[model samples]
Target: METISIQWSLVLFTALTGIAGWTFVCVAADEFLGRAKAAAFPAGIAAFVLAVVGGLASVTHLSHPDRIMGALGHPTSGIFTEAVLVGLLCVFVAVYLVMLKRGASDGARKVVAVIGAVFGVLISFMAGESYMMSSRPAWDTLLLPLGYMLTAMPGGVACYLVVVAAKAKDAQVGEYAKALLVAGVLAAIGAVAFAAAAGQADGAALGCVVAAAVLAGVVPAVCGALLPKKPQQLMALAAGSLACAAVGIVCYRCLMWMVSEPVANLFLNIL
Candidate 1:
């Protein structure tokens, strides 16, 4: 494999979109728990926008964007699989949004929410799994998908907290902030451990990755959790945390890309 191209479009698609989808799940889960409807509309809008942006970013990865339709013919291809999942996810979110707009019954909304959330999870899985290649030891571990899932947890929580603070003033959002802080710490530790185990055992890049994870995830989580439980205070904390966590996720992706070393399979006997 040649040197990996670092494209801003692909980075946005993989990290931001993954976080956005996971945020949908978190918002829906809060609703399912019988929380107030204050966040439903905003969450739906966010999900739809993220899906659209992610799809467009994907298009940028194609050299001949017009030929992208040809990808559909190869259903087994990773690119195709991601495209289909993202498309379906967008549809599910749109359906949910439509139902909300029309003032649909609670039962109908719940069903659509479940469908959207499920598709969101599948999209995150495909984002990481798409990079799975045995030739690249750094990208071959199950840790890649697991790391995405873990990081998404705090990102989702932080985003939903912001929505809740702005729209609902839900006191329960603080609890989520606390939970996310603990989760962020755990995720940071897990990330470094996984990186070390997966051919990045020791290097300046690994150190940078570890530091970013702690800063991007752990520190914000701690601050958010420590904030006063007041709705207004929590909201401010959440906003700050969201920015930090977003930066952390981007750093993690860059490090993962940097660590990708393709194994050379040269047989001297053949020569």
Candidate 2:
């Protein structure tokens, strides 16, 4: 039997979109919490741009990109549902930024923020669900969505801290960054444990997975947690940490693509 294969284009697109969604969730959370106003515009715009790029890159995965519009009409399909959630998230972030620019009421902005956060998480959940292919044993576990959430949100929060620190230079943001780092460490650990529980990976694949987890979770957590208290140091540290975390996420996704074994057990496995 033939083993299932990974799709790099889809993987890249999902990583970009996943990060974009999580970034918006972080922005919205900050907005609602009233902790960082200056960070909103830049972060929101960044998220929107990421979403656009990912949405476009995803077309490469489709044999008929021109026919992609029909995806919007089918809410029942996981891909369609994920697409809709992504679109809604981008819209909400865009609208929130516009409202901010126009000096809209806090109440109005809060409403949009809440909406954006919801859609962000829903997108993450859908991302995992989208991979629930019965043909690929490794990708079929329920832990997939939880793993996505665990990694994406922490990555997103780190991205937000980088943006905010760069633009705002607010020392107070350090505390929040620290909290996020701790959360990220915990989430990353949880994700790794969950993946182990699935019992799909072995040997070098497992080693790579663990190493990717460290790069994604431990490195960023330590960097974020140990960020210098000075405002000037914060920006550089946060940005570097964010970049590291991103590489980790990409590694994780690549491994996910690499580890699948076909359910059929016919011909040789792809990995």
Task: Compare the candidates by lDDT and give the number of the best one.
Answer: 2
TM-score quality measure for candidate 1: 0.87
Candidate 2 residues 160-232, lDDT tens each? 8888877777536755677567756865775586567656666655665676578668877877677644555
Of the candidates shown, which would achieve the greatest TM-score relative to the real structure? 2
- The lDDT of model 2 is 0.72
Looking at model 1, report the run of 10 residues with the lowest lDDT sum: 262-271
TM-score, one value per model: 0.87, 0.88
Model 1 lDDT per residue over 1-271, tens place: 3435455666678776677777788766765675647787887787678778878887776667787788667888777888887888888878888888899888888888888888887877678787777777778888886776566667767777777777777546645766677758866865675577676545656665775578556866686667655455777777877777777777666666667653553111221
Give the C-alpha miss distance for residue 100 in model 1, angstroms: 1.6
Clash total of candidate 1: 0
Pairs with backbone N, CA or C atoms under 3 Å apart (clashes), candidate 1: none
